[model samples]
Target: MNPKVRNLSTEVLSDNWYILRKVTFEWQKKNGEWQKQSREAYDRGNGATILLYNNTSKTVILTRQFRIPTYVNGNESGMLIEACAGLLDKDNPEDCIKRETEEETGYHINQVHKVFEAYMSPGSVTEILYFFVAEYTKDQKVTEGGGVTDEEDIDVLELDFSKAMKMAQNGEIKDGKTIMLLQYAQINQLIKYN
Candidate 1:
């Protein structure tokens, strides 16, 4: 059983919010054979995503933004409803998510429980997403969100559990990480269905 990486080649595919690269790797398989596999790897940018829940209000904080990819692909408006998420420049997942949550929804989440980590699009992109769930309250302070001028345009949204579930069922929520986190929260009873 021999496993070794031989060579790697990368080519730029796009340069939007995040740079996309098609990566090809040559490797030696365990059976002592050489193979090549290509994957679209997103540059490892510092990014974090989190779901904010207010159990008392039975509501969750989300964001709506226009996604170019979704728009160009098939979505009517290309608008994506998702949890608060952003790239981490100098912070860990927890810190990054907290900051993003605050910046996107004015909710300061102090305690965050890690759900899981996943690759948003492994086959074609290399974006590793860290997912988390945090508890907030109706009394939690709220303010206008959306970051600096360069990255402004985010609209904050709050939805009750039932509404969010309905959106998920109706296929309105298309972001993979958000879907996964919401489903996870539902299955774990962290969030009520109604």
Candidate 2:
């Protein structure tokens, strides 16, 4: 509720997968005139993502999966390499990311350092993504994680931190969330590399 906003309403356009809504509202311009506008927004709920790093080994864990949206948007292979992430269906950010990390990467991390939260796509998507990083050791692996659902076919990858950064620089790692986490690791010196 802002002083500049009035006459707001929302209409559900679709609810097949998650939800798509049409929002109509009126805004008071700086010149003191009211303007009406309508926009479509997709609400898939908030999500959390985590990057598993080994400081001593200078390595990081990532995941690969086929994304239909990227495929239709001219991604030739449709396979995307990204940090372990999932929608927070019924859990808080920390708990949800821990569950997702173990489910997708097979590493049962106990403590995660929350770096930041951001809206990945604010234009039309109503999802705020929580980002985190955690240290991982060989003993943390509990299972051969490839997701618990039949619909999720994920491949876990353990890559050198430097090589992963190179992948991001060369456009091989195009996912925004993954790239952001990688950069964060580099900037924060999560692992010292020469």
Candidate 3:
């Protein structure tokens, strides 16, 4: 809710997987003038992402997958390396990350610490991503996580935390969520850089 703006009308442009709406509104200017405008917004439900780290091993788990949007935009391979993440459908953020971690990476992990949450793309997409961090040991791996059959093709990668950070810094890991989490890990001292 904003005091300087009044929402007028909205029209649904697409509502298949997620809702996309075009909204018309009036905003009061600083000089006391009213301006009318229209903007399209995407309303995908919020999601959660987690960084799985092994303090003893000094490594972290990440995933690689094909992202159509990235390919369409400019990426030649259309593949991206990202942290374990999923939409918060019926479960809370914590539970969603736990499920996603196992489903996408095959690690059955508990005891996650919520780091922070953010709106990934505020200008258009209305997706608030909840960020989390959890410690993982080799024994907790219960399945060969590569995503569900015919659903997601994910390549699970366990890399040295230092290498992961360098990849993020050098554009090898281009996913924003993954980059953010890796930086957070360093700033918060989740893992020491070599």
lDDT of 2 by residue, 1-194 (tens): 69898889999999999999999999999999999999999999999999999999999999999999999999999999999999999999999999999999999999999999999999999999999999999999999999999999999999999999999999999999999999999999999866
Candidate 1: what lDDT?
Answer: 0.82
Of 1 and 3, the candidate ahead on lDDT is 3
* TM-scores, all models, native as reference: 0.86, 0.98, 0.96
lDDT: the better of candidates 2 and 3? 2
Please count the clashing residue pairs in each candidate, in the order shown. 4, 0, 0
What TM-score would candidate 3 get against the native? Answer: 0.96
| Candidate 3: stretches off by over 4 Å | none
Sum up the clashes in candidate 2.
0
Model 2 weakest 10-residue run by lDDT: 185-194
* Backbone steric clashes in candidate 1, count: 4
In candidate 1, what are the lDDT values of residues 1-194, reduced to their tens digit?
Answer: 33487678789897886788888888887788989998776675857888888777788888999888898898989899998899888789898888888888887678999888987766755668888999987656566777645756898888997789789889988787788878887888887544
Q: What is each predicted model's overall lDDT from 0 to 1?
A: 0.82, 0.97, 0.94
Give the worst 10-residue stretch by lDDT in candidate 1: 139-148
Best by TM-score: 2
What TM-score, to 2 decimals, does candidate 2 have? 0.98
Candidate 2 clashing pairs, residues 3+ apart or interchain: none
Best by lDDT: 2
Query: What lDDT tens digits, residue by residue, belong to model 3 across residues 1-194?
Result: 78888868999999998999999999999999999999999998999999999988999999999999999999999999999999999899999999999999999997999988999999999889999999999999999899986968999999999999899988999999999999998988887545
